[model samples]
Target: MSRRRRKALPSEPVRCVIETLSHDGRGIARDNGKAQFVDGALPGETVMAKFTSTRSKFDELRAVEVLEADDARMTPPCDFADLCGGCSLQHMSGESQIRFKEDTLREHFAHFGGIEPDEWVAPMRSPALGYRRKARLGVKYVPARESVLVGFREKRNSFLTDIDRCVVLDPRIGDRITPLRELLHGMDAYRRIPQVEVACGDDSAAMIFRNMDPLSDSDRQSLIDFGQAHDLHIYLQPKGPDTVHRIWPETGEERLSYDMEEFDLTMKFHPMDFTQVNVDINRNMVHRAVEWLDIQPGERVLDLFCGLGNFTLPLARSAGQVVGVEGDDAMVVRGRENAELNGLSNVAFHGADLQADFTAQPWAAEGFDKILIDPPRSGAQEVCEYLTAFGAKRIVYVSCNPATLARDAGVMVRNGYRLVRAGVMDMFPHTTHVESMAMFERVDN
Candidate 1:
């Protein structure tokens, strides 16, 4: 079969006025009845954009120069903001970014769910910069430059962006990008290392280097030295996720922890475990989820898609009993460990395929009085189908994707629940990713 050739982009930059912003933070403009997605441009701004890609329905462009800027436009904090894919809305003010996210969520609810919340809660906010506690940084050795690049990929490209520091990441690892590049460049197996996973706790930080090949003894020692000097834990992944092991501070426990002061709980997790990237937002989110659920004393609660008992442990503190269900058995084990560590005997952890019919499970026999769900980007349509069967009076849903959440919310509404309130949370700021929460109450039909 003959392959179709891609249409060549125009050589000259075209001038246009941005009419609106897309969900992914791109500016939408129309030229000759065709839509164009303009990167690095804001709504209501006029720009000269160079065409990067041409498609059948629309074209993709990168704004070369802003002829007129929006009031919300400001200087980006990161030097590589225009090139790095780490953050997309750095040019927009923090308030405007929140508004955009809220508006996106509102649109999703109205379009996908065919419903809206009775009241829109105030958007949950946090520090705009230096809040990222986790990231996977790309590592590449450039022979042409005689240096190693350690940062995010370039916008719309797989190539690593040439950056020295990150403004939004936790300073522990973000500020050390240049030093990390230097250290990797000195290593004998510099080219063998592909990426570094960064995980930061309240008191400590860790870096897991994914080595494609065996590291030399000198290279390993240098990594340890760097960790010791910077007070960062060093881990190495030789093959797979199970192969990740700590190398530095060989004496202490191989775990990092964060404290939920309101609940008086300290959650311990492995460096490779799934965790929220923004700690402040997570803490606030947990608090709001618990408060919104309104778990009365002696009432049973259920937490679905629970990881490491982040909400289950806290919910147990208030409810008579709390059950946490997760798909990953490893996370179930971690949840049990967290429950034990917190001395909460009222909670239990169960592992099950949440996408399937879990109503027949042993834990599901006893109906829950309240429920809390923190699903991933795909959302929980399967579980939402049988949500009201549990007879929960109130439910709180924490979502990372608005479209999926809206779709699932419609399912819940059809199952005899009313959308009470909903709002966006700035879990990931300066990025198009929207984290939101919605409350639902069972109607007494």
Candidate 2:
């Protein structure tokens, strides 16, 4: 006789109270013998969830019903919250979101780094909505529907959502959604254009259409005329990010820039460049990081993963010497130019990949008294290691991902660094995205 196969365990639906939210917007719920991460649930409420995926220790759950609702859960401000995949925590109160993010950083510090801040960190909060300054709007022409949907992706799906407006986007772009949809509906290359890049500044807003095929002169003229009427700078991209160009009136090399009064800095960037979506949070973050670093006069400071001198120029105000290192050569060049434009002679920028081994760089030869690092979602693991090698007295780290930051902070702790303080910055409000900053110091021998 053939051996019989074991029976599969059946998943059971259970009601659990959501005590807190994870950084990625999942609700922390514990089930029988498993840690369940449930989506579409809020803290302080009981939810009926079905286990979707189970592991040995952790499980993923989909909220089937809200057995009890949290008072903190309010109606989402955005119309596309249920459909659009862009933001997850819009229904959660802004104050509650900030609190959750702060606790996230604190928990990371205590659990992974084996350290905690002596003083409570002041949370960095910004406008609750309409703060996104940079975004890529997805475009799709549904032949069956005889219309185009130009917005963000759908919830839990790769298909584009049918959106008339996006509340989290800047008012200029958010208000133009309907007109944009109509504009594309009448365009000859409507099917060819798959994306529209949005970049906004204090004085201007730009939209760049990414098309697979070249537009006719008449179509181009139509786009230009429409853009002029709407007071938008129109650009076209037939290929990669480098191919994006102004398709309308010729502006040779005019780039957009945002000014920070606290830093006394105005930095310029290209349309297809990396930038913080929220200008207000960016300013507050710079001020907070500078305060935490406490750059004294005649002190040597190092800024890692510095993009266009966001932190370097401000740091130069007090430090005798400030060096910025970035992976992008274009950004490094722009960083230098911004420093010169601001008349900051103390800051110097170098182009080097901080994600790799940057210890061999000549700039690493000079000892830095304090270090400021703002890394992308990948987090600055290698850069943190490099900084530890130099034995920098103080280290201030800014991270968009809490999990990776916790992992990197563990490395710092293992190397004799103590987590001094950490806080959350609400850079992207109405979303589950968490932006955080932490300060560390070498333990005294």
Candidate 3:
């Protein structure tokens, strides 16, 4: 059923001041026992919201009027702010977004986990706009509309929004939206194109177009010409991720790479490779995680879900030996290749499901002095338990979701690990999305 068509009991609109932002980018407002989550609102703002959906314990509302906007609020630079689903905190300034994330982490630590950091860690931030280097764009071919949509979903709707440009994406890729849409619309495979996977390196941009059918010769030529004209590296995926092939004019353009000077690392990645969207903030986060780990010259470290050795390779610079484990075999292979390319023979990578039983692995039994985890939103609950056997004295966790992190922290606490320090990293700016880093240490023997 369409979201708009879903039957929701209507309730009276209420005037309320948004107390704060929830971890999932919603604003919290309380009315008696029924909690209301107002979308498109900010903390400290007086607004009127009309309830659209209701439940026994909570209600979902949409802001109808801003009686008094928060001082920190500003007009979003993107014209598609309200319509496009790319960003949730566009109304809030970049700096304010960081502050909001910091507050959210602090609140979660105090209330949910019954923990607090002894000192305030600097909030990691990147450029306000044009920082997102990775994204999966939704593609919709509207026959009636005589157009192909290539952008994010509309706010609260599954339908793709018709966007000409995006300010949050790296300028090179952001400026190509219109061209991409027009190119697809003109192709014989127009309706067949369903997705555009974007990956940006420090100097190059790569996009993979997912198609339902093989492209015609003219279509292929047109795609190559378009890529050449725009100086973009293009790939085509006829089926699965492994089938993706470069379609650009130059063979050299097939490779997209990014440089991380802090770790002295440069990595070559395909368009579908997993990487942090915001490069600037990622550098800071990795540096901070390494510092918190307090890695020594000869300590052994384990990096969990260590995609492309983002943390593992950097840790190798300080640790005598580093082991990186990831669920994806392809990513694990890439990480190993990256380590070799960087001449870091101290790092080893294993392709295993961290969420699954790891008692059989020799690395799992081997003791590590420290551990770092950068898990997905699902959190690393299973891996947290696995670490107990590894005998790591300290652990640093980098999380994108606070609730999951808090839940994982609960597990660690039960297993004799105490959350010694935690703070927010504003990897994404002008969005309610919170990126946080935390350190947990086992109780002294």
Candidate 4:
């Protein structure tokens, strides 16, 4: 039998009443009893949307025109806000954006975890603009435009956005996007250079160029000149992350350090190492985590997923002893060095993968009075089973993904923990990406 072809999408825009916002800030509406998700729209607004894709249950749409505006809506600060995927909620007011995140967290907890916190912590805030200190910026040399483009990818698309600069990045680098593009355009390895990882410390910034092919002498000279002009620590990675090496001013320390004055601690890290993007908020977050963890002077604590001892070293300053475990050997080695450098003799570091069966590990057998878990987006499902075995009195989880946190919270509650406090952190201020911290106490004990 001959198969019937699918119907083509409507050429003109269709009007819809936005009911609410989806998880990623898209507007949710109903049309012909099927759900329609409209992008670049707000709640309680009437918009004329164009369908981009369709599924069996819902249709994806892009709002081309707004027939009615919402109270929470505002003008976006970035010129490339509409096309850049770097930020999603830039159109909403900063205050409302944070409020939305709080609501989302509450919703996720209620829907997935089936419980709520006894106390809701206030949202942490800092300078929203130019707060990001690290990012992997994409590079593209479009022959059609006869120019190089560098920045984030296009919204809801894989293509790169034609942006001059980024407002979310630190002004030291955000304002230099076009200059970076120009510099790359003048190089012979521009096409081979797929990405530039930007990392900054308190006093310095570094850029690592991921080169697929070797750079010529002229290309190296041009990069040196660019580095001098911008005062940037330039490095080149010919292969994987391990092959990254300093190119310009190839001498002194190539490390970036951030200070947590409250804890009287300094964390030295490589540019390629994973560090929190917002420096001010990170320092504040560490302080909050330390306060919320409630580490006693004589208590033993376990720091899981401790990267470069960001939390392990700080937590050690207060606790009698802190044992850190991470999946990366390099990070574990770095953590031990950081502990030694900071003169935190009570802190110890171990390398172990927490995702799999880690019960055989040496630190896994020890009983911890308190615990701090900072797992990735997948959450700490495996470690949840061991909380009771370790006799943990209190637990603090630093989560970047709320859905995972909500799921893990359910696991912890079932294991005799009570959700005491929960709150959202404005790590990526204007973006829908949520970073949250929650505290759980062993109530049944």
Candidate 5:
């Protein structure tokens, strides 16, 4: 038997009117009762789309020309927005982007959780451009072009986009992409380098190069010179993550820090550690979470999925004691280190598998007055099952994914809590990724 060959895409462009937006920022249209997802198109727009792939249930296409534009549509700021996969909703205005995210969250709650909050808070907004502080850029050397490409992958493809600069990235690193390409092209290990991870803090930025082979002295010196000239800390990973070591500034601490002026605190972390990509939005998020929790001086607060004391230390300033729990022990250690650096002895860090039963643990013996949860994209379904055991009066949940948040919100409602207020956060301005927050209060409390 032979495998069936895939159907060929239509050679001519098809005209369609976009009815709505998909969760991933694609425009949805119907053609002969079948759905079509068109990239770079907005809802309420008429476009001529070229089919890229065909499927039985639905088809995929890219919008070649917009015949009619939506009121929310705007010209993308990035020159390579159409080619780069890093951002998806750049054509939509920032205000419209926030509205789309809010709508997405509302639909998730209504469909998955079968519920809605009593009140919806205002969406937290951030700078529409130059807000991204963390990114992993692809590096490839093309001999035909006699140059190297350093940027994100092309939309819907594995090939790197031929971009000179990224407007969304922090200008410190985004502005240097062309120079970076030139510098890498001159290196003997240009072909051996696969990617570069960039991270920026308030005062400094760092880049870690993933090198397949050991660099020669000349290549190493070249990297050092680039770092020194650009004021970037450089690290090279020859084999594995554990082998990453800093080469430039060869002396002091191997860390970058961002200041939380609201709490009069500074958060220090390694370049590889997990940190929020948008610093302004993160600061606003932290402030809002703390304010919503309404921590009192005599109360004890519990922070779940805490990483590096982002919320724990801030709560400690108001609460009598704050206990933070995380799955990664390294992050637990980092939390403790941050606590010590802040000179706060009221906060304690613990490492535990949050998905498992930890009710017997000593920390769980005493009930908490308030709770703050900042779970990952997977959400905290298992942890939601045990929230009643802690008997916290108020629970604040910060979520990166709205679907999981809705699912967990239903669990909280079923467990004798009511969804009081929920809202969205514009963390990634040009992406469909929805960052949200909700306030839950015990029915009897």
Candidate 6:
């Protein structure tokens, strides 16, 4: 087949009046009856934007200058906010951002699920800056700049942003981006280093370098010296995540951990393991979920997609017994280990693909009084159908994607569960990413 030619982007800037914000925080504007999604433009604003990509349905634009600003707009704190794609809502006030997210959640539930919660819980809040504990930074060696760039990609583009620091990331790593770039530039395998994975705990930070080629002895020594100087953990991944191993502090195990003092629980995990990027919001989310669950001392609880027992251990502290189920056997093993580390005998961990027909699983046969679900962006559609089998009185769902959560809530409602209460959580501050929790109760129970 012959190749089709893509249309060229507009050479001159196009004027637009942003009507509203899209789900990804882009401005929704119309030009000549066609919609244009513009980055860096807020609603109630008039902007001059240049088209980045042209498509049949709409064009992608990046606002170059604002003619009029939204009342909720604020100056972005980050120096590279205009270029970096790490955050999209830095220009919106924190309070307004939360309000936007809350409204977005309601819209998702009403549009996708055809229902709304009986009670709207207050939106959870957290600090807006230097709160991220986990991130994946893109690395690029530009010959024109004669330097290595280590940061997020440019807005709606594949090129790295070439940032000196990131305001949203933890200061330990974000503040050292320049030094890290210099260190990488001095290495022989700098060109082969495609990205850096950052994971931080309460006290220490870990960085995993995804190196495409072998590192020289000098590169290894330099990395060790830098780690020692900064008191950080450095890991090298020659290929995949499984290949990640510590290059610095080569003598002992340096597992990363975070403590949930509210429950007297410590969760130890590998640097590559999935954990909340915003630690404070995670704590609030856990506590609120526990409160909504209202677990009785004699009740049995089930936790799905339970990683590192973040919620299972806490739930165990209140419930009579808790069983945590996860798809990854590795996470389940770690969850079990975390349970033991916390000296919790009432909690159990099991491994199963939650997306499958899990109603027949051994844990499913057990009668539980409460259930907790923390699923990924895809949500728990396949498993929502089976939750009725557990006959739990209450189910608290912690969702990172509001759309999927609403979709699954529809399934639960059809299965005779009522959406009792729901609210948005600021797990990811200054970004369009929505983290929310919803409470559901079986009507016939």
- Candidate 4 CA-lDDT value: 0.90
What's the number of clashes in each of the models?
0, 0, 0, 0, 0, 0
* Model 3 per-residue lDDT tens digits across residues 56-100: 788888887889888888888999887677888888777777777
On the 0 to 100 scale, the lDDT of residue 411 in model 2 is 83
Error of 3 at 5 (Å): 11
- Per-prediction TM-score, please? 0.98, 0.90, 0.91, 0.97, 0.98, 0.97
- Clashing residue pairs in candidate 6 are none
| Model 5 residue 311 CA deviation in Å | 0.6
lDDT for 144 in candidate 1 is 95
Model 4 lDDT per residue over 260-358, tens place: 888888889999999999988888888988998888889999999999999998899889889999999989888987887788899889987686776
lDDT of 5 by residue, 1-445 (tens): 9999877778999998999999999999999999999999999999999999988899999999999999999999999999899999999998899999999999999997588999999999988888999999999999899889999998899999999889999999999999999999999999989899999989999999999998999999999999999999999998877888899889999899999999999999989889999999999999999999998888989999999999999899999989999999989999999999989999989999999988789997888999999999999999999988988999999999999999999999999999999999999999999999999999998
Root-mean-square deviation (CA) per prediction = 1.2, 3.8, 3.1, 1.7, 1.0, 1.5
After superposing candidate 4, which stretches have Cα over 4 Å from the reference?
Answer: 1-7, 357-360
Candidate 3 wrong stretches, greater than 4 Å: 1-20, 28-36, 48-59, 111-113, 249-254
- In candidate 6 the C-alpha lDDT for residue 218 amounts to 96
- Local error of candidate 1 at 369, Å? 0.2
Residues 290-381, candidate 1, lDDT per residue (tens digit)? 99988889999999999999999999999999999999999999999999998999999999999998887899899899999999899999
Error of 2 at 87 (Å): 1.0
Candidate 6, lDDT over the whole model: 0.91
lDDT of each: 0.94, 0.84, 0.84, 0.90, 0.94, 0.91
- List ranges where model 2 is wrong by over 4 Å: 1-23, 28-38, 46-67
Which one wins by lDDT: 1 or 2? 1
Score candidate 5 by lDDT: 0.94
Look at candidate 4 and give me any clashing residue pairs: none
Query: By the TM-score metric, which is better: model 1 or model 4?
Result: 1
Stretches off by above 4 angstroms in model 1 are 1-6
